[model samples]
Target: MRHVDELADRARALLTPGSRRVLGIAGPPGAGKSTLAAAVVDALGGQAALVLMDGFHLADAELRRLGRADRKGAPDTFDAYGYGALLARLRAPRHGETVYAPSFERELEQPLAGALPVPPDVPLVVTEGNYLLLDEEPWSSAVRPLLDEVWWVAVDDTVRVERLVARHVRFGRTEAEARAWVLRSDEANARRAAPGRDRADVVVDLDSGRVTPSAAPA
Candidate 1:
């Protein structure tokens, strides 16, 4: 709770009164980015809103079309251009208008359109997902620039792996299948996204219960 309180204050400071400030949280699967994002948004109450990057995940049908079903959480399996466009709108929303952002339905394993309403005066918008800081193609060129600050979230490998396995099991996979996917798909994606932390404005390491500044990229 103290950590969330401190994080909320850090996020609140990004507000400039009249414009929306975008704060992004990125991490490997099961690192608790969503949980942290929700806590920060709750701590800020009406001053902020949440827009998950997972909302831009390519639908399962689309993933199948692209032959990327096995790599569902990878960077290429998202609508990066659409996410960038959404951020652009959120950053400079029309006066007196509310912009609707999509939200992911984990239970349904799909995205819900126009699921979150971001009022023009919300001031702070917190978005969390896996590749917000990835240094790759559309993600690097389109999404990163739109974020005012990107926070990298992480926990120990063992904990993350266990959590992910449980999450997958809860979401319908068998225990053995869950472990396999986490090791094969999730860990690989995490390794690729890991280096992006060097460019982060802040890093939240949950296992250590610490939120610290990222070591600047060389």
Candidate 2:
């Protein structure tokens, strides 16, 4: 595993004295994007902040209205345009004032607006999500342009799947339901996100904790 200190150093290098820079961590479900992002922020102390794409998740009512409740984790289930707008705002903050961002509440499965505040003095903002590197419309157009660098978190498929199942169970699903959800929902999103690995500036193998540069996309 690449040490958290190493990740912090790389993140630090992206900062400018008076400007904000966004570093993105992208990966499939259970690839440890959140964990790694937290570690990097912790290592950077108060100089860094985190903004999560999961916060833009469409509410359950909205999902049900769209007939997409069963496909909740899929890209279309989020407010891609809104997320992109938030990134834009973060990049060009007004009057060096503190900016607030929304956060997702896992237990409630809803987004709470203005749940996180990114202070103006913080030069580095670390954002993590499954679709940060996705090449699809709206998302590709909106997200990629704002990020200074995006690292893909890679892990063994089996380990990733096991972690997904365990996470579902911990969040209130029965063992059988958790396994089913992993296979039926999370796995589909994983496959959808896999191709983005080719577009990453770096790839972090969570299984071995090693970070490597990926060949530029063809």
Candidate 3:
């Protein structure tokens, strides 16, 4: 595994004085974006906080009501405009301002509001999710402008599948169910995630744990 400490160190270095330097960690499902985001905040102590894009996911009931529950994690299932506005707020942070953000609960399959809070003093805000680099309407133009740097976590497809299976199992799926879900749903998201890698400011080989400068899409 690539040493996570190096990534955290580099992310810390990218922070500018005053307000948060939104560092986005984008990748497909099971690529370790959430785990890596937690690690970054853990490594940085008080200097960082986490804002997950998963928090923007529409609730399962809402999805079901819309007849899109089976298509969860698809781009249309989120509040893209709301997320964009939140990023804009983070960019021009005020003293004593504390912004509350939502977090996803796998068991509940919904977003829990106020789960993550960003205080005025935190210099770095690490926001991780699958679609941060997505180049589609609203979402594509939403986040990139507010970010100081963007890093995409890349891993081998095999390792990613394994991680996804383990994650599903950990979150309460049976072994067979986990594998099926990974193949059926997660892979679709992964394929959609591929193009975003090219748009990343830094491409991180999470499997090997190496970071390389990458060109943005023309």
Candidate 4:
């Protein structure tokens, strides 16, 4: 996606030293997670770089070996511990340091190592994914200590499904496959994600681009 002019300004206003702020963008499978994250970074214009949770997807072979291929994108399917560790590093960045992070390959359906680099200079690191606000073990334990703030992007169920279908189609899934995937897999993920909205520091309504602030979930 192209740069987001608005998010850039917001990111700039939030930057500072002492703590590397991580803005967690959590939503259902096809809620434009990557697009919004990219737009936020593009808005930052080099002031920030992304550390996507997708990069931690278990390798396809690992998933198959674990017999969890059918649950890909589920909260349990990722290396949640590893993702949390990386965020910890980003928060207390050491000068002159460079860290390598993983990236997921959609066509290959696998995760590649050393795909993202977080130099010490970037003050803000925007990490987007489906489970940032999940309050369960391992996954729940991973992010809270690392984030300065968390923003939940809220899109209507109908539009989100449409967006997911379009995305799967763009990625070469058949119409039938896309719709089925959205209904079965993504919708399940969405349900799991719903409880997180109450935990957000800021909730964004993508349909209207309106933001409502709320106290962090108890």
Candidate 5:
């Protein structure tokens, strides 16, 4: 819930006079990372673009083949290396060419190829996902170095979980199934991602609508 103007100002700072900058929004499920990222992009107007790590979700067939469909939102369920590679490419985009990125379709529950376009002239690319600040190999090595800055979104656990359950239900899960998924899958991912808050340049308190520089882990 941080003020949109403050977020826009931070994003604008990432813009160099003539070069591109990448600002990453990292947080666990239900933390409103996408909402915050979209707001910053909208505030920045045409100068910014968005690329979602969820876009790198492995196709359902691949997930089912790997026996990971049940835990579909887990870090391992995504094409982490591929996402990293795309970040690398976006970091050094070619002149005058649009860089296409995949997008996740909620209704279809699948990744759609080349669903988002990052035009060359865009000065800021805002990417959001749960794992951007993860220290794990390939991810830390491939992703962290490319980001100009990363902000961590934080919300109260009860509120986050409630929001997550409602999201799942809205997307076609039974209420019971939604609650089960949040407890079994999303909560586990949240725990795994908690450590990343300490690594962020800024920690956004969504419930309070405040943004502050990160300090020692709480």
Candidate 6:
């Protein structure tokens, strides 16, 4: 098991003078990708910034218009191409340009545009989401190349599902409704994303509290 500080130090190692690095955290639903990404970014302070892939989530109106509101977190519900473009810009920013990225408003279930301003000088841009390592047409072919490294977060499935249910309840689903959605929607999405773990540079096992990618540091 490894402490998050150890992970923070590893993230810090990616930083270098006059270059931008993007760290990606990818995992199944409720695997704590956001928490880890935020912690690492926080640990780095001014040297890093956070730009979430959830920010590319299709607006509720747009999702409903596209008839995909029922599967909100599924890969297709996001602007995959746009997210790739944003990452590419973060990877190679124009001089002195402060790039603005979108943010997701969970309570409102919508994405807010131009919500995060990432400066060109920030050495690390830490982004987290489920689909970063997804080897689909747009995500794998387009998005994967933009990231310097992607870590797959692994957790006890029972704990992960419980977190998903509780989160759904807290966000307005009834207890029964929450469990149903977690099992039906989140689980399905997890299956779709699980294969991407093979594409990750490392695996962060929260159950063991260790960074245990096949070739990761011991």
In lDDT terms, which candidate is top?
Answer: 2
Superposed Cα deviation of residue 148, candidate 4 (Å): 0.9
Name the regions of candidate 3 deviating beyond 4 angstroms. Answer: none
Against the true structure, what is each candidate's TM-score? 0.96, 0.97, 0.93, 0.92, 0.96, 0.95
Cα TM-score of candidate 2: 0.97
lDDT of each: 0.91, 0.92, 0.85, 0.81, 0.91, 0.89
Off by over 4 Å in 2: none
Residue 28's lDDT in candidate 3:
90
Better of 2 and 3 by lDDT: 2
Clashes of each: 0, 3, 1, 0, 1, 0
lDDT for each residue of candidate 6 in 1-218, tens digit (9 for 90 to 100): 34778988889888888788999999999999989988888888999999999999988889899999998899999999999899988898788899999998878878999999999789999999999888788898779888888999999999999999999888898999999999999999999999988888889998888786556322
> lDDT by residue for model 1 over 160-208, one digit each (tens)?
9999999989999999999999999999988988888888999898977
The predicted structure with the larger lDDT, 1 or 2, is 2
- Expressed as tens digits, the lDDT of each residue in 1-218 for candidate 2 is 36888888889999898789999999999999999999999899999999999999999999999999998999999999999999999998767599999999988989999998999888889999999989998889999999999999999999999998888888899999999988999999999999999999999987787888778952
Judge candidate 3 at residue 131 and give its lDDT: 87
Of 2 and 4, the candidate ranking higher by TM-score: 2
Residue by residue across 77-196, what tens digits does model 4's lDDT show?
899999999999888889899888788887777888999898888888999988998989887777766777777887788888898898789889999998998898878888987888
Per-residue lDDT of 1-218 in model 3, one digit per residue for the tens?
35678887898797777646889999998888888889888999999989989999988888999998876888888888889889888877898889998999987778999999999898888998888888888787887677778888888899999988998898898999999988988899888878999888888887566788886653
Scored by lDDT, model 1 comes in at: 0.91
